[model samples]
Target: MHVNARFWDRLAPRYARMQVRDPDAYERKLAMTRAFLGPEAQVFEFGCGTGTTALKHAPHAGHVTAIDCAPAMIGIARQKAAEAGIGNVEFRVGDLADMPDSPGAYDMVMAHNVLHLLPDRSGALARVRRMLKPGGVFVSSTACAAGAPRLFRWVAKAGHALGLLPLFNLLTADGLRAEIAAAGFEIVEDWRPEGGRAPVLFLIARKPA
Candidate 1:
């Protein structure tokens, strides 16, 4: 985890720039996520790189606590939030498991594009489940690397071996949904936006009320 944090800290600037690569697709994600949000919602987003998505979510949510393990990423997120005059978001450098707050504190928990990279996907999902209010949503977008072409999977493996990529769990879309369900969420939206070479699963799952 420390190594992954350092890697992300180093990549913060470039990653922030890369956030704009697909404006339409990014907006679509925001739209889909927003659909589950309410004006009084309290949101927590893990692996919130550079805070772009958090800032985007702030208008619809009452408060947002966005966290990243990388200090550099949090620093950038704070700077961006300041520049945007966004007051609803509190950017912090920490992981979900280490957050000092109590469980069932948030109306929504988001883990976009970060689930597949975690070493313990089911454990993380379970933690997120415990963090939400009953009926609250877990909104996530994950790259289904298990559905990727063999060549792409091989390249990802090579990158991991070289320590250039974080751990990949290679979960398929169905597998991811099953994991979420097993974690006690009721799957709501399971979608894949068009265009990416690899399948990218966008899901909205709710903790039973």
Candidate 2:
């Protein structure tokens, strides 16, 4: 998938409800994140689509600067934050290539599932690296085919062929670790989902102090 504005606009409804269907999964990730973040720290969530994760994690952090490339996504996110009455978050529409951000402005930066969309994830990681406070964490997750069913694997490749799965970098654990290391981040935590059924690799890495 191209992952442009249209792709997200089409995915908005389903994306908004993903948390409800898998709250446990999301909650687990949040718990992992809280392990690294200070109680009053600032969080910068790049590609914070629909604000679901932002709303869930905002109360824990002192503040959240949520951003997404799609204006439509940010529009809905702002509304969600407002309806939740969360006053600590600020939403912006911008791409990872050029963030409307000052360098080293956040204690932590989150990329979520955005890495797979990047054609050059290491370069993107470098961009994010320069934007964090020294020793800040870069928490992210990406799709992987390491545990996919053979049929699903075939389907994913087919989806790519059909352009429904444009450019996803299915980074296995070691692959991702190397990518982060190459970008000058140390692996703080890393895990592959159990059972080899879910094709996702979740991780946390940080710039050296």
Candidate 3:
């Protein structure tokens, strides 16, 4: 996680400048997530990169605690939030696992493009489940590299070996869904957007009520 944090810190500026590869798909994700949010919803978002999604959701949610492991990312997020005049979000730099336990504290928890980078995906999901209230939704978008093209997978592996990329777990869509279920979530929506080299799985799962 430390290495990944440093990598993200270095990439933060460039990453913020890069546009979403699929704007339509990204918009769809935001809309779908917003549908589950009410005016009074309290949200927690982990690995909240530059906090674009958090800022977008802040209008609908009552409060959003956006956390990232990289200090640079959180700094950029704070700047963006301020520029957007979004006061509902509080951006912090820390690992999700280190967050003080407050059982059933949030109405919704989101992790976008983050799960595959973790060493303990199952344990992370379990912690997320514990943070949510009963019936609370967990929204996530994960890149299932195991389903990606062979060449791309090979390149990714080479990059990791060369220290150009962080550790990534090769996960399949079905495998991720099973893990979510095993973590005590009832699957609500599972979607794989069309036309990406790698499969990006977007899911909305609810804690059993």
Candidate 4:
């Protein structure tokens, strides 16, 4: 389910504000990401909207390649990186489904709030896995189907009924785990933050060493 750029470009302001509103969640994911990455790790961050998480962790990784589909968000992300004087990061405008031809090129790949949005998640995970170096890690977070907000789910259902949002299966953690395993990734660590109206689950999986 590739979302149109308008959906994101229109929400860029609110999207950017998420960094401030949910600093703890972002920081937790960032800390987990750092723990998984080696000093010389080459990282690729998919859907790095406005560079919120990218800018936060780019300095810690050896090199950061961040990609996004929305041009407005990309512009913001590039500017954010520049203002931070970060020199080791590259930004691109593209979808995760059409990733570049660079197999086993990265030591880590990140996809915060990106997985469930894909209709072909298994295929995409396979691609991401291929992009990893031996023992490389894929650090990510998603709204676990079980943990998704009831109100939001009802809203989504209504939207789907009203032709607003597309309808797809609500994915649970088990579903995600199976997908990752099918993509040949092994789960290394997982977390579901406890203090939230709705919990956001994060996972760190690694390509076999």
Best by lDDT: 3
TM-scores for all candidates: the values are: 0.94, 0.87, 0.96, 0.89
lDDT of 3 at 101: 95
Residue 61 accuracy (lDDT) in model 4: 79
Candidate 2 overall Cα lDDT vs. reference? 0.79
Instruction: Report how far off residue 146 is in candidate 4 (Å).
Output: 4.3
Worst 10 residues of 4 by lDDT: 160-169
Worst 10 residues of 3 by lDDT: 147-156
Per residue, candidate 3 scores C-alpha lDDT tens digits across 117-199 of: 99898889999999999999999999988967788788878878888888888899999999999998999999999997568
Q: In candidate 2, what are the lDDT values of residues 114-199, reduced to their tens digit?
A: 88767788778888888888999999977765555678768766776776654555557677778889899988888756643356
Q: In candidate 4, what are the lDDT values of residues 21-128, reduced to their tens digit?
A: 477866777787888766577999887889877777876878888998788889889888888899888999988877768998999999987786666887888889
Using TM-score as the yardstick, the better of models 2 and 4 is 4
Candidate 2 deviant stretches above 4 angstroms: 1-3, 19-22, 146-165
Better of 2 and 3 by lDDT: 3
Question: Among these predicted structures, which one has the highest TM-score?
Answer: 3
Among all windows of ten consecutive residues in candidate 1, which has the lowest summed lDDT?
Answer: 17-26
What lDDT would each prediction earn against the true structure?
0.88, 0.79, 0.93, 0.80
